[model samples]
Target: MFRFFRWFRDFRRNRNHTLSSSPQPSDKARSPCNQPIVEATPSWKFDSKARWSKEYDLSICHAEDDIIYVENLVSYLELQPHSLRCFLQIRDSVPGGAMSTELCQAVRESHCWILIISPSFLKDPWCWYQMQQALSESPTANGRVIPVRKQLERKDYPQELRFMYGIDVRLDKDNGFLKIKQAILYYLEELCAKDREEQQQRDSENLVDEATPQA
Candidate 1:
């Protein structure tokens, strides 16, 4: 717990330094935007045999304008104890790969998608494309898609995301980030539970088969 706070403090200090030293981009899409924590080695961590196909716990979909904020959020989640693996196109996408293919693959390989819905995101064609890719993966609100509203008006919210309630960071960023982390943790824990149950069921079936006389 203490380590987590220490890391957060360092993170904030570094963030402020970067913001103060970096030059602002001329492109609107690359502009700045404004955007928590759980301390525990969650029970699921003990499940040594559990396996998941997804490469990432979360896939972040955001406009280029919001990279700084998204980067900070990702940095926090990827810290010690949490150690979450997040998929960010800017960081994880294969070099020279087709944009569409990479976007779809990212959506498919991630357990959850976080849509950073800022004004820039709404205007960016690629951001919307990524959102569409994520939507196609579930086609409904099954907790797989997490819409994070930042600097966006209520009226401007997309119709596609209306079904699932989003985390609004326009006012209370800290609370919103906490909720986002909690939501991701909850989903991951649920997956672990389901995996364990399935494994148990399979074990039982195997035992019964072994007990039966050979055909």
Candidate 2:
């Protein structure tokens, strides 16, 4: 009995330490344990007995250093095994800025870009560059580009990027966060759909090219 109680206390302390230390944005500090969203939603969206499982999977990137926002978004989505590996423009330990080649590789490798956009983000060259990179690589949902807004308007977006869709996250708060997560999931599903379309298009093109006599 005493032994079990001691073990439980130690286990909880260890978890607290482990979670607090993981390299994340400073917003995490402000995100209280009893955030308003937590009360509105259940303790765990899934089973209390079975381990909770969240379905939204997105390769996220943070633009406005929304670490708490990112954290809460993933939490509500019930991200399992943490599929979304979110990044700020630069990690705290690293001294140098991420270059074009690095950005290219990240955009190419990642399935989606969940950028937190605000007036500040629009002004930053790197964020715009990252958005452009996503546009050049996988322009649609497969290689998706999502802008989660803080207080910016869609109309203000550069004309070149007007066509792309973004996750609407303004004063809506955590519900806004949930909407962003859901949007990512929708895009991921679209990615699966687009894959089939891309394959068929390639097949048709190949047949047409093959059928034509060699020059």
Candidate 3:
């Protein structure tokens, strides 16, 4: 009986020792935040041609009478080091019947829309349609629809555009044009900053996932 009791005690001690010495899961393995990680799939291959076609930076909407002024503005924009690509209706000649479709698509694709406001601008049906399309595409505004007033008063402005401030070209041509250029650059900077932040966040998440050990 003495020998049996000693054996039993020894067995119990050995079992307890084994239990205490067993490896515990690491903090990362037991983390509640740990989830099945999924790597982002690339949308296009490295050498895709779609990369070559850049989106237009701006789309200009104006009446036929404002063509000369719009051309001059386009020329000025082209001269800048960070020259913005603009989509002018006259420059992109779609078939007569397809004008509406093309204009809507251009507004949707463009980062910003510049409306040259004048009496003729208000009088034109096509200009009104383009304005509506631009507004619809950019519901949040966010410096998308920039109105360049030409001999038009605040009261004369459309009800929808009245709340927003505009550049009055008639007041001083050079200054107004410079302001427009600066505004375009400002918006571009904002877009680039947003993209960089998003990319950084994505990269951070990817690194965390890659470092985490799987069960």
Candidate 4:
């Protein structure tokens, strides 16, 4: 009986020794899908000399903070089947909204504008300026200005932005979130299609330039 007990102890110690001898995998190698974090450096591209050159591919300006609605909007975009390539300019990324040069630049360069007009949004100057800039940049009466009203009325909307089509996403904060989600998805799909068309147009121009006479 004593010999059997000693044998079991020795076996266990040998198993542990063998396990310890085996090299542990590094964090990156532990998971086959592990990818190194790539730092996002700004690769700015804009037409400096095009007859009609826009500053951005597709820019979107939104205010985010304690508002669940704003966060939800971002969350929905993040989960899209077709990725939305956009930057939301804010003061802080972790806690939320803060106006800066980024916010201003984003507003100026943006093709798409998402205004979350809660009661708190009205008193803010940055949001107001962004709306102004968007209108100024808009080509005609039929301009693309998307409003995501968190909680506000027509009177609350910037006078110039009033005529522009709005998504009235306040319903998302109401009884049914699905209906609101579907509506925004439908709208975003259209935006995605428009971006595709614009991209194709840019590609065609590039091909033409290559084929044309060069000095």
Candidate 5:
């Protein structure tokens, strides 16, 4: 028994010595538990492609009186560096198409809707209809609706739009438009992040399936 115990102790000591003498990767070169470190690849990049299969980046819902001003805003958005596709009922609508169909499609297909809440807009029945339609499409809002208050009074602010924050362009058109552009870009980036996460999940699932053995 004494000899057996001695042998066991010597074996343990030799094993320890052998392990200590073996060449091992440093902590910096290897992960915890001696696993090889793998550098994570970047999963996303900024691109000009449409986000989430949306047809247009922005849909302008405004009164006929605001068409000229909306056109200028559209031009700014569509120009280089911005290059945002916008749905304008006046400019992009099919010729002889029903007005209701055009308005509904514009609100439905766009990633975001901009309600130009000018005085004329408040008075226009069609503008009010579109505003309600936009709200119905995105009840929680969720960065989908933007209300631009142009030459409108505080008392005249639409009751339905009171819940969400809006940009007031009554004072500075350039500054307001810039803010609008930034908001749209921010929303698009968020959508892109979601898309990337979904893609990563799919890739991981594929890898798991490939590694799984057949019965």
Candidate 6:
């Protein structure tokens, strides 16, 4: 009877020891936050002009009569960080005889187009062409076109522009300028968000390719 009891006790002890010594499943491995760590890509360090010389943050399209106002606007924009590389015909020294192919290309490359509307501006055919091209490139009016009314009423503007909200600099120059700056900043923020999403997707694809087995 004593031997049988001792054997039973030893069996229980051995079983318990074996169970404790065996490796158990870890919760850490099941946690998503602890799995599949990915390293971030290093940021490219280069001058913005060197990286995107042909592209511009904003393009100002206006008639020769409004050059002074455009210059003032450019000066104000230059105070901002990313607005240093604005495209303007006068500043760029585009050929004065006629609108060249380079000029049109510049307008297309611009992320945002600002039109200074005035009596003279309406008289110029080239200005109208620029407006048409900008609208075609960015169909979403809220995203691209920024019109600054100098001495025109909403009714006097084109039917297409009449419905769109524009900054009226004729009445209040300061407030209108501020609104233009705010619009540029808003558009730039949207562009940056899009770039970040595209970069993340590229990184995830690269990681999957790296983990795939070779045949």
RMSD of each: 10.9, 12.8, 28.2, 18.6, 25.7, 27.8
Model 3 residue 142 CA deviation (Å) reads: 0.7
lDDT of each residue in 8-126, candidate 1, tens digit only = 64466456545544443332122122222336556455243332567678899999999988987776565544556677787666656678987897888888899999999999999
Ranking by lDDT: 1, 5, 3, 6, 2, 4
Q: Candidates 2 and 3: which is better by lDDT? A: 3
Q: Across residues 1-215, which tens digit of lDDT does each residue of candidate 4 receive?
A: 64564466446544644553354444213211232222122212212232123333234444445245554444333332322233444312212224454466565654455566666677777677776676677645433456566557767776665665665654533322233334434444455556667878999999999999988
Weakest 10 consecutive residues of candidate 3 by summed lDDT: 43-52
Q: What is the lDDT of candidate 3?
A: 0.69
Q: Which RMSD does model 5 reach against the true structure?
A: 25.7
Cα lDDT for residue 161, candidate 4: 57
Flag regions of model 1 displaced more than 4 Å.
1-51, 173-175
Error of 1 at 187 (Å): 0.6
Candidate 2 lDDT tens digits, 145-185:
77676667767766655666665665564537655655655
lDDT of 5 by residue, 1-215 (tens): 64564466446544644553355545234422233333232224334244747667889999989887787777555543335678877656665567898789878889899999999998899999999999999999699999899889978999999989999986663637666766787777787777778888989999999999989
Stronger candidate by TM-score (4 vs 6): 6
- Best of the candidates, lDDT: 1
Instruction: Work out the TM-score per prediction.
Output: 0.78, 0.52, 0.73, 0.49, 0.75, 0.69
Clashes of 2: 1
Over the stretch 1-215, how does candidate 3's per-residue lDDT look in tens digits?
64564466446644644553355443213212232112122222211222124356788999988887887777556442344567777655343426887788788778789999999999999999999998888776689889889978778899888777789987773636667866776666666656666767989999999999988
Q: lDDT per prediction?
A: 0.75, 0.54, 0.69, 0.48, 0.73, 0.66
- Model 4, which residues run further than 4 Å from truth? 1-66, 91-100, 139-143, 172-215
Tens-digit lDDT track of model 6 for 42-139:
22321223235336778888999988778777655644123335777754533333456656776777878898988888899988988888888877
lDDT of 5 at 179: 67
**Candidate 3 C-alpha error for residue 59, in Å:** 0.5
How far does residue 55 in candidate 5 sit from its true spot (Å)? 1.5
- Clashes found in each candidate (C-alpha, N, C closer than 3 A): 0, 1, 0, 1, 0, 0
Q: How many Å off is the CA of 5 in candidate 6?
A: 99
lDDT of 6 at 119: 88
